[model samples]
Target: MESAPAQPGTAEWYLAEASKLRLTPLDDKDADPTQDPKFQERQRKIVDLATKSVALTHKNPEKKQQFEVSARYLLDARLQLAMTGDDEQVELLYENARAFVKRDPASHAAAHGAHTLVNLAYHNATQEKAPDKAATWRSEFAQLANHYLQTFPREEPRSVPLAYTAGRLCEQHGQIDDARACYTQIVQFTPDSLHGSEAERILRRLDLVGNPPPISGPTLEGET
Candidate 1:
């Protein structure tokens, strides 16, 4: 028999009972109704339970409850690591991310798990200023990027970051027009996101070097 829905708090017992649910339709209104995109609830529970088990400190979770949420998948965790100047932690974050990808090899949800892998593994080749350590993991990074490109969603209520990442990869490949489409999508989809400044830089870098063309979308409130 299926179990009852877990309450928000004190559901650690329930959350710990992990099960693999892959190939699930993202559009189904009933799809993983309990799944939070950022896994905040399980994370909160894990932090709360940290004192109880020496192994559940974000990296390790008891088998029954696999909070196995990679730091990359948890924006808050990544931000904390950045604040603490923990590059090693960031690397561990990628390792955890890879594990999530492995856990559900056929999952579309596993797509973003590849995000950190690309961001860290190929930040240089794809980003504007290539880094010094270009040789660290080029082949593996390229393979991951290709895999992401193959599975990327075309339409989304929030695809700015997705488009931006695609543009970066195009920039590396010298596909100026392909990159332009991706950046244009970024400006079109989520102009107000944290990527605004970076997106603007990219638009100009792609040769839209003058004043930005007037954007036509639902204007933000208070903007005449």
Candidate 2:
């Protein structure tokens, strides 16, 4: 039988539990759990737990850096949860992301936290019903995506996803040239990799044959 959900706990306990969840695979029986509601629920729960853990670390300076790392995990998991289109849940998740950034501005944590905001903004634009709000979110996404791409360390392995995210954000906002540049970087940096393959598909979709139109001297605000 499956186990019952855990009760919320102190920072140390929550952090430990979240760490275990992070290390564990979603399910051994299912080859892919991406579409599994149970998987998502579990992920959401784990992220919530992580947020609680972050809360406990607020007063401990030694744990502040650790909170940054946990925030990344929390934000990613929260985004996954938000994909279910649970509006109330998404609102809380957004707040959680905001709290994460406010708590720690460490570069690594901030990068991941920025990615979380991008996901929320994109979700608002594409999935929500409010046009004005959607436009606002898209605008935010564009700025966040650009900043993430520009600031993240190019040599780090983590740059792959950040670049891909920037490309997708540009594509969604109709900044074709900027999107292409970001995608092209992924391809050039790691041609045979997953992100590179996805980037190539985006380029093909944009119908650009060569060099992505040169990014065009900044000012990559996208169409609403």
Candidate 3:
């Protein structure tokens, strides 16, 4: 009983602390029809299970496989939390994901990390609601993203995410042409994955926003 409290230290408190921390995980999502009560319940169960599974990951070599599963689980949970608007849980889940990635090679994490930072930064940049810490998170997220780009080099599948991250960073920083450039690159390089759809959507968004003059040339990876 002692382990639990009436929301004893609900994950909310850590949101600020976590935000201030050096590493914040990325954001992603799940299917909708999430408005249904039953579906919502199911989602919560899945999140709980995912949280537990991640909690069980061991550092030992024999348990290395579990670590990967756990990292992925946390990633899924982060997506779910974002959908439900539980930003605190999203942040906490991100911490777990980052810690997990550090333990091993986070294949998709580099991109995912960039994704979260962009969301955080974009929200901050919004006209109506830039919270006090918004700039901090925006900067922090950009650094993490640059770290990913620098560390990972080029993989055929990863270009779209990299493009998205770069585009979001440019948008947040007010580099409209740079943003257009990144999105255009996504259109060219990431034409296969789910990111391809995202790339198209972003291109549409850029058009709507009237960025004008898409940026051109090879991606940071040079597509070699």
Best by lDDT: 2
Q: C-alpha displacement of 183 in model 3, angstroms?
A: 9.3
lDDT by residue (tens digit), candidate 2, 102-177: 6655545666766676666666666657767765655565565555555555533655675677567667766666
Q: Which stretches of candidate 2 lie above 4 Å from their native place?
A: 1-10, 28-34, 119-141, 150-224
The TM-score between candidate 2 and the true structure equals 0.55
**Candidate 1 C-alpha lDDT tens digits along 52-152:** 32133334334323343322225333423422324665575566556656666444325556655555545444332444444333434545544554455
Give the true-structure RMSD of model 3: 14.0
Best TM-score among the predictions, by candidate number: 2
Model 3 misplaced regions, further than 4 Å: 1-34, 105-145, 154-156, 159-161, 164-224
- Give the per-residue lDDT of model 3 (tens digit) for 71-187: 444455455555454567657756754665575544454345445544444344342244545444444444444444444455434534655775686677666666666566556
Clashing pairs in 2: none
Error of 2 at 121 (Å): 5.8
Q: Return the TM-score for each candidate structure.
A: 0.36, 0.55, 0.45
What alpha-carbon RMSD in Å does predicted model 1 have with respect to the real structure?
15.5
